[model samples]
Target chain A: MFAPRTNRLAVLARDWLRRAVPRSVRVEWVRLRRLPRWILEAPLMARARVEDPRRDYPICLAWHESPLQRGLFEGETELERGKAINVAIAASRLDGVRVDRFQVLSYHHLVGRPSRRRGFAPGLELHAGEPAVGIGGGCCQVSNMLYLLALRGGMKIVERHRHALDLFPDRARSIPFGLGATVFYNAADLRFENPLPFPVLLRFDVRDGVLRGELRAPEPPDFRVEVYQEGHRFAREPDGWIRENWIRRRFSDLEGNELRDELVAHNRCRVCYEPTSTQTDEESRAAGPR
Target chain B: MLRALVKGAGLVAVARVPGGAAAYRRLTRDVLGTQRGHVEKLRRVVPGYVEIWRQTLERPLEGARIWIHEAGWTAYWPAVCYRLSGRAGAVTNCEGRIHDQYLSRAIAGAIATEIPNDLNDPRRIRRLRALLWARQSDELFRTLEGTLHERCVPTNLPLADASRDLCHSGGVLEHYRPDELAAFARECRRVLKPGAIASHVLDHRDHLWHADKAYPFLGHLALAEPLYQLLHGHRRSLSYHNRLSPEEVVALFEREGFRCLALRRLVLPERIYLDADEAARRGAPGLSRRYLAPRHRAISEADLRTAAAHYLFQKS
Candidate 1:
């Protein structure tokens, strides 16, 4: 609930600061913000151990994949390469991990802090609806995939953060807008618990220009999960133009009988660029994204 | 031919899509109306429980006080005890956590619906069925509910010392680590009457192979010790296995003041070989000693191949 004038001023200020500060200094500042939470959550972290994959893996509950390096926008080649490197590093730590029933998988705990010293390169990160180059910037894609995997796997999401700003237009977006999670180290962690009676495996593979993730189990799961968006709307607010959507999940038995439909998240984010169909009136309208 | 290969690959890719496995199971199980659960398999095993008890006791199971350790969520042992002994004897169902009444009732309903014909006694079946039928009317489930008695301080079992005539479990020991087995054995000794009998079935093979048919039976033995321990050493692991040989398990019990009366090891013929090198020469995968963890490599080939063991012991 911000005034439109104040929101404009805040946006201008953020843009000015982004240009004034060096990327290294900004990276250090972000790390500093995360330090306290990192120290506090150190003992509660779950880590993956080095073990050969089991032969009889449970049937996969869900699987998702995205192009490893799309390089859709001009001058994104270097950032895309850095992002792939960061993702590969994180995937090695997560692939073939088994989360037993009642066990929680913490994204930051498993992936650790992604810093330049740890071989993470300069990747594109969005700050206040504007893209900038920063260390470990593109790891958000990994967190996004993990969040969706947990949702489809029927896991209980313990903690998650939604991006406050919509940075880019969908060129060839497969998933819904604002459906992804934004994680910032230990502070904004992506955590989910396996609520099933059987243990679930988190398998990630980055190969042949595809980053694939799967939630697998030792046996076929009895229920099926479907995630969809509801009540999607674009509103012109006193602060600025914003998009909102209710993301929901439905669970059904293998027989196609509905078990439960639950609200996963309600996302509302400020739009950085001009939306094609912007409402001049104050009333909210149910409209699809352009 | 190339088109067919491409089609096959495309199908495989589609099968890996999100929600594909569940969709496939639904299509086959629900649409096709197939009974794919373990219900049929469990029905076959339920009758054998009485035979196992008779063999161990060398007499009828009637009027025998039984102590079952770690009956798990299903309360399978208590169900079997009720079916065999009815009101003649009582069972002390000891476990780390409380049993789920709904699941226990479901099991009882399944058992009573089709009392296996092999049980042979119409009188026992009639009484057991009637009692199980009455469980639905009771607000509190009385099928396995009783006063919990704990005499030993801090022990997992809640029963008086020398109060129980027999202690038994099936497929429960391998879940305990080697160190844990010693502690469990000590607890068993304190609960049972002097010279009382204890019988247990322990699985020694890699549990992963049972679920995944393609996995080698001894594949777990080939891993580096630290890696295996890191993965399945945690108590919450579903595929947790101590990987102890039949002899090692017996020795551990003997150390805990129990005399091992019988150690029956069941080995698979195809899994048996003269030595690791010989097995590898015969193209027996996962039998390579060079890849085995150091501790497992020290075990005899015969012992390593033992898939399971049934032990009968007496308190010394």
Candidate 2:
């Protein structure tokens, strides 16, 4: 939603200060303190194994990467560094991770907060409904990808947070915005509880400049998961308009027969960009909700 | 390696000739049949109505009331309307006389044939795609006359009571404002008897995307509302600019007392740019600055963007 308007001079002054200090320097100390934590967390990393499998994962559990990468990590250094940190998370926390029945895969409990000291670079991030730069800024990207894999892999999500607003444009976007998960260090995390009888393997790796990940188990999933957006609209709030969407989840049998489609969550996020599309059909009218 | 060299030499030889690209295109279109559209060929895939009953209706089309608005001049929606409703007591076709006649013809042509719908009822589409394949197009047109009561209206329809068994619209509601659409929906609801159905192909894409590739589908959002009206509105042009996303349309239907039965939306996956400076140059600078609104830039992107939505709703 829209924020209160500040005086132009104040806006300019704040921007000048922001530029003077630079976000990298501003968030450095916050990340530097994480160094000791990272060291202490080293033992946890060893628990997650990174390996190249001698055999391929089941085709059903394959990961697909996105070609729509603009505005996600715009700068080259930030982009490469974000990817490096993503690989680091895959190596140190996600790779070879296993979950037995009823066991939870707590994102923060296992991987910990992505820290600058852990070698994360400044990348695109959302702060207070706006895109901003921060240490381990794009850590949410990895978590989001993992969240999707877990869902499709039939893992039960015990806790997840959606971004306040969809910041990226739709042009060539790979997944629906409202379907994503937003992680903020230890406070906001993604946790999945395995419901299957067998243990499931969580794997992540970089493939051709894109991050590819998957959930592998001996048997194909019994219930299939597909996520979609529904009832998406821009609702006017007191301050400004925020985009609203319902992330709908559909379950199907392994044989590809649909069982039911249910509403998973209602995503209400700030609108951070102009929503314009051509009107090709007849103009139609709508009344506000009754 | 030898095959690669031969292929490269062939390409060089073609490049050496004048207008080879044009010639190749001509050959492709003429020899490869690119210019021809296969109504007959398409029929093989979708099959016919008569088979539309892969699933049965609680209310059969027989002696039912139905409405098909903006069926267009040559569209075959009436075949679908009639097949589902069958010799319905009454049928309403909005878009005037000629459009109604076309509907009548297609329905007649399809009367004799009842191929089972080939899709096995998995993909959701109501109308028969091969309604008037070229081979049967003329016969279908000649014998379209039927005894069922048929009415045609050009714009706003005038009808009363819970009379219609079914009401349908194909790709027409996207041009009206949400309020006008809501009114139209109310009209359908009023005319339809309780438990009747309303269905549509509800296309929500920016028509200009395929019309011209100069900009992203969302490029029109860069211009201020006033400027957009100036160019595409009835003030200067006949084109209507609804710019309503699929979600907005669904919301409108819901508000108008329609229960969603089925919604299969097509998501477009493409990133488009609408920069602030670009928007300013395209429209008024001051308005463009507002277009870039606080903390938001000219560029907007999202995945699973609904290009079009196909839905069925039952009147409550």
Interface RMSD of each: 17.7, 24.2
Candidate 2, A238: how far from true, in Å? 4.8
Task: Name model 1 segments beyond 4 Å from true.
Answer: A1-45, A128-130, A278-290, B1-316
TM-score of chain B of each: 0.67, 0.57
Could you list the CA RMSD of all candidates, in the order they appear? 18.2, 29.3
Q: List-wise, what DockQ does each model earn?
A: 0.01, 0.01
Candidate 1, A39-128: lDDT as tens digits: 654543445452655564648788899987765666778888898999888887789778875456889888888888888887888765
Segments of candidate 2 deviating more than 4 angstroms:
A1-59, A67-92, A236-238, A255-260, A279-290, B1-316
- lDDT of model 2, residue A52: 39
Task: Give fnat for candidates 1, 2 and onward, in order.
Answer: 0.00, 0.00
lDDT of 1 at B116: 41
Q: In angstroms, give how far residue B165 of model 2 lies from its true place.
A: 50
Across B178-213, the per-residue lDDT of candidate 1 in tens digits comes to: 777788788889887887788887767676566555
> Compared with the true structure, what per-residue lDDT tens digits does model 2 show for residues B194-252?
77777665655445554444334444445566765555554223245476655566678
Model 2 chain A: ten consecutive residues of lowest lDDT: A279-288
